[model samples]
Target: MSLRHAVLAALLSGEYSGYQLTKAFDVGVANFWYARPQQLYLELSKLESDGLISGREVVQQTRPNKRLFMVTDAGLAELARFAASVSKPSFIRDDLLVKVQAVDHVDVAPVIAQLDQRAAAAAAKVEILDKILRRFRGDLDEETYLRHGSPIGPYLTCLRGRLFEQEHHDWSVRAAALLRDRATRNGDPPPVSGQSR
Candidate 1:
């Protein structure tokens, strides 16, 4: 999906400045889509131009003037229409998976380190998502919420992101395990052997 659509979806929450939208995207929408602040800024300008969103300047004395955006009726109609359209599922575009596919011919240490990093990052993200889940649960029960939630997409996406991060952590743990096991199965690194590199 386009960042325009993502921005539009964000605007569905309420009016938000570009800065606020960036935070919303990072915290909520990053689960499904990734975009830089510049990209979001560009898209916001485009959406304004397209009449999908309306923006007003917010005066600030000490800081840069902010523009708060509210989704227009046309935007809402477009979103509803987009929702009615069938969407293809996202497929993986992971370099790590590609690396894993070719691990046999490569050194294991750096890759294991990289996976370790990914796992750590995922763990941190999962903690943040857990907090979101708590806030999500603060409202109605699951049945009622899912049926009539104000905006369930972010909550649902966080669930998916939580799972996705967990999978990364689990896979990294297993990959690291396999790498260490394989190393142990080898000639034992010559036991350090009092040898210099």
Candidate 2:
């Protein structure tokens, strides 16, 4: 999906300034789509120019004025059109997978290190996503929230992110352990922690 559609979807939550949008993307949208602050700003400008979003300047006494943006009617219509269109299938395109594919030929030390690092990173993301999911549900229990929550899109997406990260962590840890065991059986030296080579 285009960044435009993502931005429009984000704006559906409410009006947000550029800074707020960046934070929202970081926490909410990063799971499925990643866009830098500069890229978001650029997309916001483009959306505004296209009449898909509208922006207004808000004056702040303690700080410089900022522009708050919201999706326009056109934007909602565009999103509807996008939703009706058939989506292309998603595919994995990770470099780490490529390395793992060549693990038989390449040195196992670096691959094991990378897998360990990936496991740690994925675990951290799982924690963050758990907190976010909790916050999204508030006092409502998960079943209750899923049954009767307003605006469940973000919550659902965050749930997907959590699942993805949890699986990633599990797989990474498993792969690393298996490789370490194989290396030991073959009398290869243990990988030095945090060493790239």
lDDT score at residue 145, model 2, on the 0-100 scale: 95
* Tens digits of lDDT, candidate 2, 1-197: 89999999999999999999999999889999999999999999999999999999999999999999999999999999999999999999999999999999999999989998998888888889999988988999999999999679988999999899999888888888888888888999877553111
Residue pairs clashing, model 2: none
- Find the candidate with the highest TM-score and give its number: 2
Where model 2 places Cα greater than 4 Å from the true spot, the runs are 192-197
In the range 87-178, model 1's lDDT, one tens digit per residue, is: 99879999988787877888766666667777778888888887887788676776776788756877787889889988877787777667
TM-score of each: 0.88, 0.95
Model 2, residue 143: C-alpha shift (Å): 1.4
Residue 45 miss distance in model 2 (angstroms): 0.2
